[model samples]
Target: MTAMHRMTLAELVGGLSAGDFSSSELTRHFLDRIAAHDAQLNSFITVTEEAAMAAARKADEARAAGNAGPLAGIPLAQKDIFNTKGVRTSCGSRMLDNYIAPYDARVIEGFNDAGAVMLGKTNMDEFAMGSSNETSWYGAVKNPWDTERVPGGSSGGSAAAVAARLAPAATGTDTGGSIRQPAALCGITGLKPTYGRVSRWGMIAFASSLDQAGPMAPSAEDCALLLQAMAGFDERDSTCMNEPVDDYSAGLTQPIDGLKIGLPKEYFTEGLDSAVEARVREALKHYESLGAELVEITLPNSHLSAPAYYVVAPAECSSNLSRFDGVRFGHRCDNPKDLEDMYCRSRGEGFGDEVKRRILVGAYALSAGYYDAYYLKAQQIRRLISNDFAEAFKQVDVIMGPTTPTPAFRLGEKADDPISMYLSDIYTIAVNLAGLPGMSVPVGTVDDLPVGLHIVGNYWSEARLLNIAHRLQMDTDWHKQIPEAFA
Candidate 1:
């Protein structure tokens, strides 16, 4: 029999159903791996051993009684941004380091109801503000492929945990490229559903209109299973769509004979690395052999995505983070001269440098005199970017491109250069601005490090995207590759 730690989520489910192993045993196997290996990765913030054991035991009992849920007995990691009842929901900042959520977020509730065991909360960039996990208050998460290299952010901890086999699968949120970027850097599959596709009731907001929760795992098939439990309508969050959720796993085996793939000329421009582009182009050629047609498309406004995102995201972040003032439940200053002093000192002492930079930028952009010039102008540009995708979709079923300009870089490589770090998400930010679904699939490696092929689909087309990614995985072994140290 294959080792429990090496099995994918689906394989684990089959093992549990066949009575080859108890949920308690599988849970312990993962817990032991985390203890043995996490010292080198710094991926997890908390490990809920006692609670996880109790859940596993309950799942075993339910399975014996023939009342198991679809995902019963699976152990998964939750990103710390999601609120879990009685658990610390720090959005990776000292401000809320002591804040324990009184209720579960909608995503957490969905996973719990599906009978998944929460292994613990993974670390993340402080307030989900940076492109590399270096901005995390706890510390930067190390990439499993090479301990000296960084795992991408702000979902770097979740990505690192899954790649290292510390967890079978994990939950992640994407405000810009948080989920997909890290998954690409770590050589795993990640899916960022359309905006409002997954409820954000208790998710710590970075950009209210753009933030979304998704799944990260070993393959598109595993992501399909995880997404099935996550997608649904929730009245608690006003932004959540009332549209019906589709069975994400049901269409994984669907054929893509006449699929049209868009190759954006803009995504293949000068800044892209030669090696990375080669892998992406090769993957597109494989799709061509599968009878999928490739068409040339243009997103002319794509060059303006970074500037527009910088303005809009920070503006929304400033408004959302205002609730963390000292008078509230977060960190408060010890010595206070006055009410104003307390507010200033609390925020000054609590927030990290990257978070402070974004807050300042946001406040400036939304200030009285600059609001029309900066904020409004950024919004107009955002609309143009969205329209670019709308027009391209009329000519293609999905867009193909390189996920990042290069593979994982050494730790602290771009930490001093904020612009360079921000540009790390250049290819991914436009999708969020347009409210479309996007995913990253492992295509191949460059210099022993993994590269990802980016796929963008129209809104509510997650099922079709999964089918395409799954078909590619069937023809290649890239997604199954594991880091040597971890393996």
Candidate 2:
């Protein structure tokens, strides 16, 4: 009971069902942790203490009546990117800082329906724009492993919260490797379901086509349970897939024997840290021991993924972010000279530096004359990257690689160098462009910093991906290792 904060979401569910702890007690324990430890991590933007306690009470009552749902009473955090009814849904920017969402995002609705307690909204990069959480207007999230280092961006707060044991698990959106990158740096598990596998209705858009919400937790098994509740079709969101979602948790114990693990030659190139590469290679060896075969595969166009992503993501973001112009529900500048001035001032005042940079780049890519040269060319490259994956999948079940070139780097180390920051997501962006499911599992550490083994699967292969990761987790303690300070 004293170490309740250390339990995974799956363990918490078991404890709740076994009557070892009431949902209210569990919720209170997490709320207390957030209150105590989150100040240092700066992971949470808001803590819905009253709503969480109320929900916990209701869950306890339902359990007593023998009508509890699978995730009933589990305390979790939501990334600020998701709209929460009656709560501030800031996208970690000044623009939405004062905006309270009128309704819950579909994922929020799903969790609420399952009677899960909403702990709070975790911080994120402003408009999900940066590779490091430093882009967040609320402030950067410090990696729990080492406060001087960053918890990877965009979904950084969610990863940091779960990694630091401030919350059992949290929701995160992956756009250009946000979820997986952060999870890897924080030594946790993150799953980015295939594009359209999860609804995007109430998720604040970054790059519409690439933004997919998923679960970030301490273990793949914990992610499976949360994904079970988070993923599915939603007519309201045209991007949501209508296909039936497999019971993700049902196959956790399924054997991954004879699984073909593909190693992309492009992912292990010059820039990769030697220590990080060694750990990833060791992870592949472990999978080989589990009866999984390793195949050397080539994603020839993988090298072009970063360049293509830079263009395509910005173009889409420019269009999507245009709605935030002062006329609507976000921030508005006071005493405007005219409509043009208002538009200029509001946007200029609202967006952070990173968001502004992306917006300008996006606007340029979509410009009339440059559209074909830049945006169209990038789209073609995206298709090539997707085709490479298609060919690789023909020979292998899943592609494996290093999630990042290195582990959690010191905060501000690359803040001024945008190129270095963008390169951090190089290994992960292609999966998003190709609309594939990808995950990051803590495999080992390099120089005492966590390294993630990247796993990518074909479309709708989330179940297989989870099974593979869970098998590895069962044989290793990396995912279970918490920062000594947090522990």
Candidate 3:
């Protein structure tokens, strides 16, 4: 039998359901791996051993009672941004280091209701701000595929952990390209649910309008499994839609032959690395070989996404982060002249430099003098960006592109330039602006680092996207291949 640490989340769940393994046995296997390798990967910020074991025991009991679900005994990691009951939810910021949540985020509650075991919290960018995990207060999360490079962020730890087999399928939140970019760099499958599809009640706010949670795993089928449990509505999040959540896994077995796939004309343009473009183009041919039709589509306003998103996201963030003024919770200043001084000093000390920069940018953009020039203009651009998608979808079932411009670059390659790091999200950001669903599936690799094939669908096209991704996986060895370092 293969070692537990090398198996996919789907394989583990199947084994448990068939009585091939016990939850305790699987739980211990992951705990042992975490103890052994997490020191280098920094994939986890917290490991919930007691809670995991108790949940595993409960799963065993449920199986005894014939109450097993697809993920009954599966142990998975959570991004620290999620508020887990009695568990620390740091959002990778020092400000809330000691703050434990009194309640689980709606996504966490949904997963618990579905019988999945909680592995622990994974590290991420401070307030989900940076494209690389180096922005984390804890430390950078190393790519399991190439330790010398980054895993990608702000969902960096979630992707790295899944790639490293630290957990089966972990939860991640994307505001901009966090989930998709990390999944690409880490060589896994990750889906960003359509905005408002998943309740964000307990997720620590990054950019309230853009932040969305989803699943990351080794394969698209596995992403479907986890997404099934994490999505839905909560009255607490007014932005959460009351619409019905469909079974995301239903399309995993369906062939995508005859489906219309549009390739954005701009996605393959300048700034794209040759190797990455070649790999993604080949993946498209593979889909064509499977009978899917491909056509060229234009998103004329595509270049406007980074500029527009930078404005809108920071504006929302400035308002959301206003709560961290030292009086309520999180880090507090030592001795202060007055309450106002304490509030100012604590936030200055707790937030990272990048976060502060965004706050300042956001504050300025929303200020009366600059409102019409920046914030208002960005909102108009956002609508135009979304309109581009609406036009493209009218002619195709989905859109496909390279999840990123290149494979994971060496650590510090783009660390000094914030604009460079933001550009890494080019392929994934427009989907967020449109509030549509997007996914990243392992396609092939360049050199040793992983590359991802990006797939975007109209709102509620998750099932179709997963099905196409799974069928593509069936035809190739990409998803099955693990990093040589681990082997």
* Best-fitting candidate, scored by lDDT: 2
The digit string of per-residue lDDT tens for model 3 on 1-487 reads: 8887677777888788888889988988888878888887999999999999999999999999998776887899999999999999888999989888889999888888888899899999999998889899998889998898999999999999888787877999999999999999998899998999999998999888888999999898888888889777779999999778788777688877798999999998999999999999899999999999999999999999999999999999999999998887899989988989998999999999899989999999999889999999999999999999999999999999999998887789988899998999988888998999999998888987889999999997788888989999888877766676554
Off by over 4 Å in 2: none
Give all TM-scores, in the order shown.
0.99, 0.99, 0.98
Looking at candidate 3, the ten consecutive residues that score lowest on lDDT are: 478-487
Supply the global lDDT for candidate 1.
0.93
Compared with the true structure, what per-residue lDDT tens digits does model 1 show for residues 130-162?
877898888999999999999999999999999
C-alpha displacement of 301 in model 1, angstroms? 0.4
Between which residue pairs do clashes occur in model 2? none
Residue 185 Cα positional deviation in candidate 2, in Å, after optimal superposition: 0.1
Q: What is the lDDT of residue 266 in candidate 3?
A: 95
lDDT of 1 at 385: 99
TM-score of 2: 0.99
Please rank every candidate by lDDT, starting with the best.
2, 1, 3
Q: Is candidate 1 or candidate 3 better by lDDT?
A: 1
Which of the two candidates, 2 or 3, achieves a greater TM-score against the reference?
2
